[model samples]
Target chain A: MRILKFLLVKEFKQIFRNKAILVVIMVMPVIQLIILPLATNFEVKNIALAVVDNDHSDYSRALISKITSSGYFRLSGYCNSYNEALVLVEQDKSDLILQIPPHFESVLLRENSERLFIAVNAINGVKAGLGSGYINEIIQQYNQQLRSKLQVPGKFNLGPTIQIQSSNWYNPNLNYQLFMVPGIMALLVTIVGGFLSALNIVKEKEAGTIEQINVSPVKKYHFVLGKLIPFWILGNVVFTLGLLVAFCIYGIVPLGSLITLYTFVMVYLLAILGFGLLISTFCDTQQQAMLIMFFFIMIFILMGGLFTSIDSMPDWAKMAAKFNPVSYFIAVMRMVIIKGSGLYDIRGHLLTVLGFAIVLNAGAIVNYRKTF
Target chain B: MHSVIVSHLTKIYGKEKKVAVDDVSFSVDKGEIFGLIGADGAGKTTIFRVLTTLLLPDGGSASVGGLDVVKDFEQIRQTIGYMPGKFSLYQDLTVEENLSFFATLFGTTVAENYELIKDIYVQIAPFKNRRAGKLSGGMKQKLALCCALIHKPNVLFLDEPTTGVDPVSRKEFWEMLKRLKEQDITILLSTTYMDEANLCDRIALIQEGKILSIDTPANIIKSYPDVLFAVKATNMHQLLQQLLRYPERLSSYAFGEFAHFSFKGTPDTDGLVTYLEQHGLKEVMVKTADITIEDSFIKLLG
Candidate 1:
């Protein structure tokens, strides 16, 4: 116990004295929490649209006004011919083209239907898909208005209409930042905890100081715990700072009990820190440790259900996500912060992370050799 | 009572399985200053590493303080103090912090063993607050020594502790070891400097993972088998060339301002001078030279 105390003091002093580590610990949470969430928004807006209106009729003009007023698109060009509108798309000036054939209003009234052509630039698939979907929805609504005006509403009722009274339970406003902040907090904590502890022992190896430690009477578990406790505290500090950034910038607060959230965080940190120490034992230099940790961290973040939903992934990817500790933390963070989940709700996640902490730490202690 | 003992210890490295320490054996009695003298890559460090419990011997067996190196390594680690060839203390930590850390790591306080490290610690006490990396090479050596000695272990292993230190510091370091020896701490140290070999009570001259000879400094010199001579002339390089061609020459090497030469049979100083002058070398001089440890080392290598 005395040995562990001294080791912790030494590790903390060295960590705080290193300007590079201090900078990383302080700057990473702020940048990841504040800037990344705002930049990673998937909501597509401001699509440039070109209109080829050969009809020049009242109905066609009304449709154009409706599309522009919907605020999903900006009218970038107005042309007399379809070829002219095609030129706008080719020049990258427009993302979509809406063409109304001649006699559009007359045909719709006389024959009950008219053809409208929409040409989308499919280079950015998501933008094109969403842009086309929005336009289609608007045209359907306009067609409904025309049908009701042309017929008597009481005589010709359009069957029974079923409306979806959809209400978002957790986040009513559908704010993207609220959904992203907790996951980003999980990512930030993983980065700070994983990288710092991974580099800790390897730095001693490069400096030749580990040999001194190895020859001492200090037990392996004592040394491992010494390395773990300091970085664990630092990980908590980074996490708290992330929470502050989340609240101050995005006006997000944990809906659940703070004690329950902290319980999960404490266990998750142990699992990640244990993983870092395991990598440290296999590496002889800081560069090796950094590269190995980077490789694992990249995989962890991508498959972690942070930016992508796990349910939508392929079978192999879902399997990978199932094994990822980061995914569990992201899940728990969202559940506790947004869903107001209690300990009973996150019991399974908490137990899995606790298992990770035990297995990884045991592996690290076993692999760490006092002799070569 | 032997504090450290090895019999035919071997260490093979890497997939290539190159022999690093080959069939080497030696022993150090209690409280004696034993040195392993060799140049770099002579396996001095490897031997030190094996005995310190940082490495396991590939073959044979070794023990420290009557504990087996491979089986009883845990107890061995507790009783040994090791300072690697490279300065191995935490460079970002202050000197005092490093000392205190090692002290506490051994489950003791600095105040508990203050008497053991007092002589050396006093020298570095003024710079206790300065980070170790900023210290000079000599100061770094001293600080490393202090950290190693903080626990006052039964055996101390120092690997090239004075390799890059200045002359004055190296001299002072040896003096500190002498004082440490009086405290009844068994010391096992390695050095590449031949002069430092004399300071050890006994040394094993090693090369290429093998021991060439093992004896006290005076005894090793006394056992030299040939009368050696130092030869000099106006054209020293040409003189060396001519001396090598001498049929009776046993060994020849350039040492400082003169070339040390030995004969196959007996001292033929006059004949050698005449032979050198006949070869057109000018102002030739020859004198019988004292056989230092270096000369004995060269003789033994032959």
Candidate 2:
């Protein structure tokens, strides 16, 4: 431990001496946390709604006004024929067409019911699906309004009503940053902590100081730890600063226990740092280490479910994500912060990350050559 | 007991099988300043690397301070200091920081070895706060030597330490090594400059991964089998080309102020003088000269 302490001191001295790297470390994650979330929203909006009305009646007009008033959609046009609606869609002016059948008000008054058709441009799957669902909900409310105006009995209202209500529990507002900020925190930590530790030994090799270290009595584990701990601490600093930005700028407060969040962070950092050390042992130059790190980091990010849902991915991609440590970090970061989950909820994830840490670091220590 | 011992050491690098160090063996007694004299790629650095436990021998074994290099490497590392051919100090750290860090790595402090490095470190102490990369070549050399000696190892392996320093710094460094020798620290260093071989108690002249001779400086010169001669002319460059044409020229090379040559057999000095005069060479002087390490090295290579 004495040797390890001195080694850590040296690592810290070397790390802080590079003012450019320190500046990059302290400032970058905060900027990313603030700016990146705004551009990655999944909530579909500004859907172009086109309406075709055969009977220009109060009831139909009321429904049209109701559809336009909701902010989820923009009215593209009111057309006379379906072909005109099709032309609007082809022109990219409209993405949905709501058609009111002939004798719409008459059927609504006599039978107290009516049916409408919607021709949606399905090129953009999310916009098309959500647009049609919004129109359907509006018509359902209209049907209820007509029955109430006629003072109809409760029999029809009770006939077959399955009131489906959903609550977007953790993020009720569905703010994308609330979802993205935590995941981006995972990415920032991986890039900073992983790349820095990966370059540590290889940089020594390039500078030739590694010969001095290798010919010393310092154990391989001590050397690897000295390279790892500083970057791990820096990773946490980046994580905490990002959380602070999420709270102050985006008004986001993690619902989970800070204890749970921090615990997982320690384990996740261990895994990432070990992976970095593994890369350092295999590479002889910092550029080679950086290139190999970039290749793996890219794979880790793309397959880690940071930007995309793992469940939505193809089977092969999902299978590949199972091996990616970054995916576990992102999962737990989101689970603990946005979902406010407890340690009990993330125990499985914690174990997986811990396992990765042990295996990768053991490999690093074993693979490092005392005589090179 | 010897400070370091090697037997039949061989190191081969690359899939192309370049023999870096081949079938080499030598020993250094405690407190002796031993030199490995060779040009670049002559495997002097390779021998130092093998002895210092920075590299493994492909075929043979070495021991430092009575610990086998392959089996007891950890213990061997504690008793040795290695300065690589290049300046290997951290460029980002201050000199004091670099010194203190290396000291700490060896489980000691600079204060503990102040008596050993004080003479060298005092010269560069005022620039302790300066980053190492900005220091001049001489200062870097002093600083590297200070760091290597901070732990007070039983043996020091310095590979071409004065390769690029100014002559003044080079002389100062040798003075420091001599003072280190007073403390009974075995010094094994490699140098391409043949003149520096005289500074050591003994040297091994090596080339192309082979050792040609190992002896004290005086003995190696006395062991020369050929009669040596020094010849000079007005056109030194043309003189070099002309001397190579001499039928009896055994090994000829341009020494600092004159052309030092030797012959396969004793030459008629008056006849050589006549040949140079006929060639329109002016200020011609021909005389027998004593053999130096450089001349010996050239003769061995020839």
Candidate 3:
């Protein structure tokens, strides 16, 4: 234990002495937290729309104005014919084109019905899907307005018989930044802790300092722990800074207990940093460690359920995600921050992380060969 | 009891299938300066690493202070101080921090073993605040030695500690080692410099991962089989070529300003002088030379 204190002091001193890595740890994460949340938003807005009116009637004009006034679409082109609207879409001036049939108002008054055609550019799938959905909602709202104007309560009732009154429970606004920031914070923590600790023992190996340590009476567990705790503490520190960024920039605070959040981060870091030392033990050079670390981290980030929903993934990837420790932490982050989930809610997640921490660390210490 | 003992130690690098140390054996008496003298790749460092518990031998056994290197590895580690071939002190750390860290690692304080490293550490005391990376080669060597000795282990293993050091610093380093020897600390060091071999109480000459011969410097010189003659001509390179072509010449090599020549049959200086003059070589000289360790080593290589 006394020897471990000295090792910790020496490790910390080395970390603090390297100015470039220090900046990468403490400052780079803050900048990434600010930029990634804002840049990686999923909410697509400001779709361009083109309109064709065969009957320039009040109904047509009202519908046009209403769609424009919804602030979701902009009037990019006005086509005199269906062919012209097709041209507008072809020319990339519009994402959606709404075509009203001839005698549209007369048909509505005479037969109490009308038909309209919508052409959407489906090259960019997400934009096309969301854009057409918004147009359909506007048409439905226009039909209700026409019905209400036609009569008082006895004559006409156009309101839906059963209303949804849909309210997004946790994230009322559906702010993508709020959803994305915590996961990005998890990624930065992984990078800082894993990258640094991955190079720790390998660095000593390259410098030949490991020979001196191997000949000394230092226990393998003491050496592994001495390398682990410093980075684990720094990982939490980086996590705290990320949380502060989330609060100051995105106004996101964990609705769950802060104590529970920190407690899980502590366990989460052990599995990650211990995995780093595991890589350190297997590699002979820092470059090899970095390459292997890069490979694992790339897989972890892509399959971590940070960007794509795990539920949407195919069966095989879901099975693989079960093995990814980042997936558990990301779920923990979302559950605690957005759902206000308590510790009991995350009991299963805690068990998995605890298991991972024990297994990865045990593997690292066992593989750390005392002799060359 | 001997501070270190080895019997038929063998180590093979599994990947390359190269034998790094092959069936070598030696022993170091307590408090003696035992030098393993060889060029680079002579397995000197490999032996040091194995005995220090930094490496395991594939065959045979070794012990430090009567403790088996394999079974009592932890105990061996506690009793051995190792300074590897490379300057392995933390380059980013201050001199004092590196020393204290090593001292504390062995469950001792630098203050507790201050006397053991005092002679070496005092030279580096003024630079205690400087980063070790910025020190000169000699200063780094001294600092490494100080860190190794801070725990005051029973035996010291230094692998080519003077390989890259400057001349003045190398002399100072040997002086420090001589002082440590007086305190009855068993010192085992390896060096490629043949000149440095004479300073050891006993030395082992090794090459190609095998021990060629092991004895005191004077005894190895006395064991040279034939009398050596130093020959010189005005044109030295051509003279060496000419000496090799001489019918009676068994072997010839350039050493400094003279060509070392030996004859298979009994030599006559008058006969050799007549041959050199007939070959039109001017300013010819030949004199009987005292055999040094290097001469014996070259002769033994044959």
Q: lDDT, candidate 2, residue A116?
A: 88
lDDT of 1 by residue, A1-372 (tens): 877888888888999899999989998789878788999998888899999998999999999999999999999999988899889999999999999999998998899989999999999998999999999999988987887788875695767776568898999999899889999999989988888898987898899988898899877778778888998999999988988888898889999998998899999999999899899989999999999999999999999998889999999999988789999999999999999999999999999999999999888877885333
TM-score: model 2, chain A: 0.85
Chain B TM-scores per candidate, in order, are: 0.98, 0.97, 0.97
Docking class of 2: medium
Model 1, global lDDT: 0.91
TM-score of chain A of each: 0.95, 0.85, 0.92
Q: State which candidate has the highest TM-score.
A: 1
TM for candidate 1 is 0.95
**Candidate 3 wrong stretches, greater than 4 Å:** A48-65, A74-123, A143-162, A370-372, B233-244, B268-284
DockQ of 1: 0.83
The TM-score of chain B in candidate 3 is 0.97
Determine the C-alpha RMSD for candidate 1 after optimal superposition of all C-alphas. 2.2
Clashing pairs in 2: A256-A340
Query: lDDT score, residue B6, model 3?
Result: 88
By TM-score, the better pick of 2 and 3 is 3
As a whole number from 0 to 100, the lDDT of residue A77 in candidate 2 is 92
